[model samples]
Target: MAASTAQNTTGATGRTTTNTTIRRDTRTLPAAALGPENPLPPLLPRNDPHRVSEEQRATLPAEMARQIGYAPLTTVLPTRIRDGYTRERVPTAVDVIVIENDRLRATVLPGYGGRVHSLLHKPTGRELLYTNPVLQPADFALNGAWFSGGIEWNIGATGHTTLSCAPVHAAVVPAPDGGPMLRLWEWERLRDTPFQVDLWLPEGSDFLHAGVRIRNPHETTVPVYWWSNTAVPETEGTRVLVPAEQTWHFGYQRGLRLIPTPRWEGTDHSFPLRGTYPADHFYEVPAAARKWIAALDETGTGLVQTSTGALRGRKLFVWGAGPGGRRWQRWLTEPGSAGYAEIQAGLARTQLEHVPLPAGAELSWVEAYGPLSADPAATHGPDWARARAEAEERLTEALPAAELDAAHAAWLPHADLAPTETLHAGSGWGALEVASGGHELPGTPFDPGTLGSEQRPWLELLDAGRFPEPAAGAVPGPSLVSPAWRDRLECAPGGPLTDYHLGVAQWHAGDRAQARRSWERSVAAAPSPWPLRCLAVADGCEGHLDAAAERAGRALDLALDAAAPAAPAAALAALAREAVPALLAAGRAAEAGRALDRLPAAIRAAGRFRLLESRVLLAQGRQDAARAVFEAGFEVADLREGDEALTETWAALTDDPLPEHYEFRMRPS
Candidate 1:
């Protein structure tokens, strides 16, 4: 059987065919007995961030549209049709509603182009499909895409939730090879809630396909965590393995990689988990797979969990490493592998990793799994190496590097500005006053507040050139919400703000024109805080750098929010300083100036990470202040002895901040 190439259906792992179009009960088109081709004109490319089409959701059918008094799927593609769900189920919040096939008309399996939400599968293995809908986190502490390892009590009947399926914007492009390919159109206009989708694997075909419409219909972002539940059969006798760079081991050689803490738990990778009592739990998977397979070392029960999902890489426990397994079953009954299951709390994407997709952009996570052993040909050799690399490339879109860059730079556009109106409204000079013509200081960075008692003593100390001392206080520390809450609300990493962060992927990978359009999509998807700050900066860069900043900033914020020790204040200092220059370059001088004035002077005196504070000093233009800043904090002694980007930036500005070795070490020199 040929697997679907996404290029077309012919030669796809299975022999497949799309039967003649079935007219909707509503579209009285008896006369228009549609030919093999679609009657509608091809849709425009969906690039608008404000529209659902761009988010890539399948639309409602003509019948459902008429019933609802509005047409759908007009903007999306690979429509849903037929009446009454030919399948059924009941989906309470935690449980899934399965929709099975009675007439064999439905085709949705991992490989059938179903676009399942998890990361692993077989039966075509192209994409994973799910019967679960999107879930949200009502509380900041919990993951939105929650999962339950309890046995599925009832795969209910009567189609749990009624659905309106129709053709979406994606069109089927016929390849020259005579195989049919799908080319999605009008993706920007088809937005709405993501619904529960099911799978139906035919005995012979290589492809099964389905899609969803995750829309942000409002001007605001729609926060969500999608969960997937699959029923992978359980076998026996096989071992289990969790993939990750650092793993914790437990019973029977079971391994897991978790966030290390003072007191750690779970089986780690380096250790072996050998036991016979039933065992199941959660653990971290490696960040890189290189298409590597964490096999169970048997004929039928060797695969435990795999990385494979279209938008999100899935984590599964296979009966022999079944599909998308969660905490319940990672081992089979016989000894080969175990049953497979999909577990995710929507803490993020494909798995429980907490990945978010900005409003207008698409975030895809790809992973692949099949049979393998240490036998070189399949396990440690060319074939294994080749497939592993290929799989890695598939999910690279969601890799931490690029998105991390975007998220870190998310709030960058307003870094240089003071948070209050006083410092900014009075001087248009912004950071220029502090760093003009190589005369800026080399102090670490700091943001000032409204000048309160809390910051008063520190300011005095900073003015006197004594830094970082204020933070030595016993009670209120980095965990304390900076008493400096001056109406600064940013997007929580996976929250509504910075919803446009996902747009970077499209821009980065698309063509020039596509990139520019995606840039607009990026801006449009950003949170309100970003645009407000950008307006505080300038409008031009708002679409590019500012957009990038919003993504990066939100990611950084999420990281900070999820951070173990949870220090918002330290993150603030770091996030703000990095944001300053970008905001300045973006031309939001006023905003930049406002933020600059907010730096706590104490950070200035340390001269170590003093760039933030030094920025303010340079602004004061007290040559002594500027020089003092240049001389403070973070002893990267070899590199001007500082652990501050601002210091590095300042040294680069001051030429001799350490000249002789300057060009040799500092970048951007």
Candidate 2:
């Protein structure tokens, strides 16, 4: 790493400051220093017979092999290099760095997920961000264990990206405005992408500004997701304010649904108004030049998060005051761990929507988290925004005009310094669209009444049975399984979907016995519909018609019974395609007919589903009906001629047999 320092003098304020190299050092503290701990066993060495790879068996040290099933093989862990582990209170050390100005101070844990662990308001002696009292790990991350609190940068594929729990490279750089800045970054191996975030605390400022950059270093375009997650203490009157027109809900048993925010009667879902069931949902804030979200406590003091550049979405997740929430708190922290709510912002409109990062392209953005003054009487959406704006204006007026202009140019060049666009008072479900340009300043004549309808045209098209043709490429086949896929499966487990991928890898490797075992374990563990559908495909390939029908029926039943916030529209279509064929082959023609008839019209109209319908019709000795269905599908959209499983299954049904294997895209966890 290289070091750089600079000094600049401000003429207006007659103040001089020097930007020095970011200082990094190590500090030792008690292992339980952050919080209490009902420490679970070390996360490795679970007795899963299928987990022992040939490489591990061949290269294991004698000592490691002896404790393979009893203790964690710390040295072989993918992310962290653990010095040691203890069940009781023990001394632990981590790399720490600090960046501060006159009014605010931030502590960065470079070795522990590069988390901004502590943000303090020097004048008030208040910790503006929630600080976890203990450094405990829990099974919350995609790779099994993660620590809570602080602002975690989630990149790559969802659910706390791989780097969330791992150490990242850090450095101190002088901000363009001559302020102290801390930069931390890591290369994500799975996506072949590199991401970096610069944390800048300008002199005498209360806000901590973060600039993020993500680059796709691969030759091909890839799907990517980015979110900044911050945990804040939740008090009785804690409220979350998001400047969005509508909200979308997705979770276990909750099918995809849209609703109005803040004004939901009986229960104000906008904030922690009343504690009932656990509420975990994502809200899509239409793209606006001035994007902001905040969480305030009873005393009116809280954190306000604003972003510029490519980030466009915001999410609020609260573990309610129920038993499940309590259990989750225990799992994530020690005995005295306070209940906290997460305020998250993302790069896309919704988590389910994948944003494409073109090859060799980069995305850049800035997000600022600052202290918000309390307004005890401000409870509604408009009131909260008003109070926040006033506080922001006070800070702006206190800074030198030149420095303010330079700072605005540095992070928000495209956005004008203005109050957010006016929001409509009326409520209704509508298509959540991204805003076209930057937020308009207040007092500028603008219409708040007719922003737009809530109905989404793209969603309406999907509902109308029109799907865009698949991208031009051979649908990835099982035969194309590579070493990278195997490594990913090995590194990430504990999810039914990951298990399904493992089964797919095993099947492709010519190991049916292990494949079946893996699939069975997957369903036993989570019962998500994906693995069941895969098992049905395997049974069909083996000519076990009766067993195939049974599995396929179960898959359909589970999917249909799910209270999915949004229909797993694509997944359901795939399931219908597989189940119809199996049901027909098992001599259950009536059941097969019912299965096809029950599919949503929009789904049944899809090219893939129509193909499956045609196959079922042909199997029932109705060639004319099958031909009509096939032609109708083509009329809807020109079918992309790929999908090895569909092609092979159609061939086998037509007495034109091909090699047998299951194929599906891996879903992000």
Candidate 3:
């Protein structure tokens, strides 16, 4: 009976009969690690004077507590207060798992987020993916630590995913085709979900196969966002190809807007052209059957990413060649290193879109990353599409139906798998052991808004060292705020504007003393009203009414003197709003009235400034006028307003004792 079954079917092409083998090696290398001993620090100080008071927390709703991951007005919020990875590169050892066959070699860093550190095409000895020179971490992750380069598997919530910087269970398995494979598994604590990725380099194949599975372990439904971010060398002629006719553009502050792809006029946003401005757009890949995206350089040598399962979203995120782009490169990598662009694929149509996994449900798919040869000049829309189709055909041929199905079945019993054999440092070849852990890694405990807005013109201005002047008849940029601004300041410090921005970030982070110090430094460098106004706000928050009044008076004078076309009206409005409170606190009701009178009508009508007006009227012993101001402000923009700026203003005015909500801001924290 066994002999009869062994008989081959005519021209079935089910499995490979040829002798092929793959090698797996593991080594310990010096790298940074983040865990309980070294936890990430809070972005803001806990003792910040501006923090919501205990009295305020008591009045807030329970929902707000759940949203912020803590009770309202609590002094000690249940934040994920872990120290970040140390910058001092120590001799801390890390496990490096290498899997290779005749055609390709791939390295996996199991100790560092289980990322595919490098993928190389053996035939050409060319790296198929961008490899970071160092294993450095930045405060860009939703949990407050992110690293650039290579391929990062983002699962759970948005941003870089909670596990991007954490270690995952990894192991080596025997491929059905007789090649070696590496598998990584991570249990997401936040969502009570478990996920795994099985990677292999089949013999005689140029592509690396990644089998991904995400399972819901809970009884209730779970919402999830999964994306694979692959970085490649971006150059003047590097072009990204995704078969999409139109794209959705989502900016830092700018919401969703649609634009045609391949070309966007004057911009020529076609992947081959050199992008002058930063772009973070998502293109919908309606090609439900087979999805593919790639990035090719001028040399016609590049890499392609294709998925055999559902792929609703394709993304191209590039830090343009402009000053802002350059600064971000410096921030994410070591200096003098070339910046790279990202070609990403997701299960949803957009980054903000998520899917709900039913109880006991599981979703599985396969993705391929391979090298491509093409005519660089001809690798546009149709040309790239043809190349993708050919690549898919090749992959299908290499991974036949019988062999692929067997491999899928092996991965389904994730927990029953044996431990990966560990290879000691300098061992000829080995693999890292991976197994499911009892718990998920610690992630950010606070609400998403704690990270702040990514799109701040003030930050770009500080990085560019020049104000962003609008074109004739164009509206000026929006006002600058704290939030993620501190992360930017850390990258490039020393300038007057940078210091001023730093002060704002510090103030928001609850470090009034540091905020004052930064503002003082800014005043010394450029003597601008911006720094003085920020200083006044800090002083008032600290209960230094007299000092606040003096600073506010000087700030008001400087703002009036510096008022010009280039000056940001938003800054002027900020000064007026802050000065009135300081003057009122210092028992200078008349002075507060004068400051209120000088404010523009538009500023007075603004919700935040209206709160200031009410404060000014109250200090003048006119309680009725203050109430009227609050009533009118609420009538125009209620506490439930959708706009973040207005909602923050409402929180400040009502002293709602609840944390400000900015959940509307998209992920990638």
Candidate 4:
């Protein structure tokens, strides 16, 4: 789908400019299809175990302390893991919306979580952001399927986002500067909040202005997290500058510490390539200082991002110069792609904390993206203060703080205007929220026309007073764990399906006993594998390792049985992955081997399965066979950030140094 709208602007010389355009188009790139999401329910808790130092925690104000770590996710229920994507790349067409003026062009991917795919400076023919050559999905996202590069809007917890591989609604609207604006809006599931991003390029202006708004329509306060992460090309001389003397450093060791800026560990860490490992630096910008961060190249010309006062924090994340970091970089995209670093702005001082948003209230801010030019000597100088001052002055000259404030004021009223034309359609979940809660969101409407199959059961529960059960062997729908949904599920008549979903909701609410009873009733009513799997998770959470292993094995067998086709092969493989680990934990190595042998040839041939195969082999005392698994060159696309399982497994196999392909350690030993 393609549509265009142009605005004519009269300049000071009484000349009319007629080429300010906002249009929708398509771009074909070498991309991998993000296949289906895992069908099984998330039975375990998904708490963030990242540690913070006492020094870091002591510095937090009262309000920040109260809001930090609030509403930790019990499970990623209702959202599923997207592990079906492989490393295979083919030419695929992706939807893009271009917001352009005479000076710059901002191309956005609405179907891919409203990511700013490319920011081009028209005058210099330069791409300001790190535009990836291929769209390869990786396991960096909270719900899986994340690609590197460009600017991404992360709204859920401390990972990439649940919507990293999903879509959002997009439309064309009027900009505050009388030009056309491209609007992207979605209902964030994790926080149950509605948010919108408005992108526009002022006529002949150098900056691309973005106005962001997040609303909490509930009667109670909600924990909110928002970060705009921008990826920029990193080179030997590229330096990141922010007006700060100190920072909070968080490494993969899972500890945060206060450290001096620019120079650390006998090297200037602002140059990303100088570091030996991946890490995060949350710059402690003073309250009165200008809120801006800039990344300048060797010539002192690159991108600068400046926002209003509401967006308070700035951070720099580097992949570093280590081979493990390099392997991760190559894994995310093409091996030959230029290295990149992330400069991020968030509401909290660090991504580990979440701020509180009052009920019936909204938070809004304006950000400007444009080119910055400074003296190479000053920006790359040994004096950190001098480099920061130079960058700040250049940013002020490019886009004044007062002008950005004025832009925010001008955009407040326009943010409530209805979208003029729809460009793309997203999921039906937002409309279901609107229909259930009767939320009066004005500008970003959740039209009933957008509802689809994923939301049908919940819609029936809302309208018909019963949760409709699907036919046997049909794929299960997502689980809703909110209080309102729980109340509805509890009030409905009990059955196999109702009891199963009710158990999930109860478990998320921390009512373990009731959840167990509900699942037991579900199994009694219908002896299926899902509820039994839930019981296994409960058993594992407690210390009943034997019972957990037995239940897990049963679930795997039932899921894979031809008579009971409850889940797809991908979901069955996920079940096997979990069950084999449980069996190994219970000292049932021979049973784990038997389970692996029972799997279909194609399912057992996956990369993740190959890693599991090595684990099973090691448990069976077959060290040689286990070593061959790593030598076969398999990649675990879904390997988590802090997971050291691969390294531990390899160490057990041999005493030699870990190989480069298997080395993904982000921290020092």
Candidate 2 lDDT over residue span 115-160, tens digit each: 8888887788888777876676543454434677889888755456
Q: What is the lDDT of residue 402 in candidate 3?
A: 48
lDDT values of the candidates? 0.27, 0.56, 0.57, 0.87
RMSD in angstroms, candidate 3? 19.5
Candidate 4: Cα lDDT at 230: 97
lDDT of 3 by residue, 1-669 (tens): 011011111111245423233233444433445533111112232221112344543443443222222312211111232233444445544556676665777877775567888998887899988887766665555444567889988876545665666666655544445334566765554454667777765546677888887776555777777889999988777777666767766555334556877667656565632665556667856654457777887666688887755555788887666544564566555667877998998877566555778877778877778887765445643454564455445445545434544555644443234434432211100010011112221111111121222233443444464434333322222223323335556566476656765665565566778878988987897676667766776677678899989898888767666634434455556456567767877999899888777766865666556666766676677777765665553322111111234334334455544222222222222
Q: Report the poorest 10 consecutive residues by lDDT, candidate 2.
A: 423-432
> Which runs of model 3 end up more than 4 angstroms from their true locations?
1-93, 380-416, 420-669
Q: Rank the candidates by TM-score, best first.
A: 4, 3, 2, 1
TM-score per candidate, chains pooled: 0.26, 0.53, 0.54, 0.97
Q: What's model 4's overall lDDT? A: 0.87
Worst 10-residue lDDT window for candidate 1 reads: 153-162
Model 4 lDDT tens row, 483-600: 9999999999988888999998999888999999999998898877788888999999999999999999998888777475546777688789889999999999999999999998
lDDT of 3: 0.57
The 10-residue segment with the lowest total lDDT in model 3: 427-436
Which pairs clash in model 3? Answer: 25-430, 26-430, 39-82, 39-83, 40-82, 40-83, 40-84, 159-668, 170-434
Identify the runs in model 2 with alpha carbons over 4 angstroms from their true place: 1-21, 27-91, 380-669
Using TM-score as the yardstick, the better of models 1 and 4 is 4
- Of the two candidates 3 and 4, the one with more favorable TM-score, higher being better, is 4
lDDT of 1 by residue, 262-330 (tens): 113442211112222222223333334322223333342222222233322223322112121121221
Model 4, residue 192: displacement in angstroms? 0.2
